[model samples]
Target: MDSHKILSLLGLALRGNHLAVGEEPVEAAARAKDARLLLLASDAADNTRRRTVHFSEAGQCLWLRLPFTKAELGRAVGRTSAALVAVTDIGLANAVANRLAQLDEDQYGEAAERLALKAKRAAERQSELRAHEKNVRTGKYRPKPRRTPEDSSPQVEKSPPDRRPRNQNRSRPRRGSPTRSPHPYAHSRPVKKGKGSFRKRED
Candidate 1:
């Protein structure tokens, strides 16, 4: 069937629980070997596409390529870039196959040709998923490293030297008059103002 019709059929099959999603053509091909049906994106690489075709031919699995981009396929399958989806359950497989057959008959006169195309696409998707998985496992798909404690540690600033205390810097008061003078009236003698005799009243 055409990519669009195939995608529609695959989309319906995905609602069932028998499908395995893959990001690489190899993985998709592997999944397809045990699956009743496989779905692939139309825009997968040529090498992946050829491998998928070979896989389908060797395994006798039904495969189809949707007319969507990898990104579109990913979005449809709730992933970033899904290459393949395999239907594993026998009942689900039969149901999807029957539906796909009907869609192929209705949409394209060459049901056999459409089926072949579908198989090719499924293989491609599987291969893509396998490659992607390999890259991730090998650390080729390395993510940004997170910050460690050393990277985020707080810096401590050194304090300045302290000055001397006020008592240590104090000096004696300046001298002007007598430094230890006594009371101002200490040597003064009292005289009677209205005394008649020259002798002092010593009583």
Candidate 2:
């Protein structure tokens, strides 16, 4: 039994809804004869281990110690520490138990465990939020100040933009003598009708 294969199968059992976690649930499953196999964490409390063992024996089901500690088991199951987990499906239970018997660690189980932990974190976060809210109600909560994006990132101070007009940099054209025009009729006077001033001579 490869440890990874066992853990992977357990993870699959959990995902497939073929497994149960926690003492009460496992006990209930065992009592109902729904549980086919039981997995106890190596570091489970003595009382919990004893109780689970008793239930397993009474239910005529086989119980095995997992390679992982209680914390690791709980992490895999999306809980703080799952002392015992039961497989409800006969096929999966058999497969998991057989794999556990072959027991060497592998990489596949790590992915399963990581994925299980990620799935459980959302619920844990919500629980934490609720706890924080309760603390607030009791006036025992001190929320950490939020870090603004501006505060977290480096800020460069820039000089304020010049408020003067855009053309201020260019000198005003001096108002002096009028510039000569390039047109041929630059000095031509206004034309008058029935008069000879700057017009055709009287015929």
Candidate 3:
């Protein structure tokens, strides 16, 4: 089908059901899984192209690679760098499928074949990525063994002990008793002298 016809059909389909449009191929691919048809530009990136093709093949959805420029594709779908567009309706679904089938029989056959090949390659790449991710998650990719507490203990030399007593004078004074004097005069009282009573009568 012509690009204008495809665009009109897509608009009708979008009007009939909820449609999700994306500027990136990955988002478009995700939406395409539940969509009746997916639309992409001819100038999409290798990754985007592969993803779009994969979405179409894996989901059994009709796909169209428009010959318009990125800007034109964006204008057609009302976004910039629009790599993917989804149409979700039974009527539009059947129309897009029929249109794409007719295009595949005509001038678009070579492009469709190339998309199929790219989709196959993308599928293989996805499988490899998943395998690598699983290995990493399961710790199969790591080679070094983890360290344990036994591997980190330190070795120390033994030392000899001293024999000296801890306290030389261990006796403790009673709570109410007088403390022992350190000198002879520490507790002594002063002596006093007085004259006899007969000496006082002379005054």
Where in model 2 is the C-alpha error above 4 Å? 104-203
lDDT of 3 by residue, 87-198 (tens): 6543454555455556556755544455455556756988999999999999899757987886777756668776667564447775888876789696776655674445
lDDT of 1 by residue, 1-203 (tens): 44455455456656764557773543554544665655667688887677667666766776666446888777766778876666664445554445555655554335445455566676798899999999999989977799999779987787987688867665454566445436776677766778555777698
Assess candidate 1 and give its TM-score to the true structure: 0.39
- Mark the regions of model 3 whose C-alpha exceeds 4 Å error after superposition: 23-33, 97-104, 107-203
Please provide TM-scores, in order, for all candidate models, with all chains considered together: 0.39, 0.49, 0.41
Cα lDDT of candidate 2 equals 0.76
> What is the number of backbone collisions in each predicted candidate, taken in the order shown?
23, 3, 0
Pick the TM-score winner: 2
- Residue 196's C-alpha lDDT in candidate 2? 67
- Rank candidates, TM-score, best first: 2, 3, 1
**Model 2, total clashes:** 3
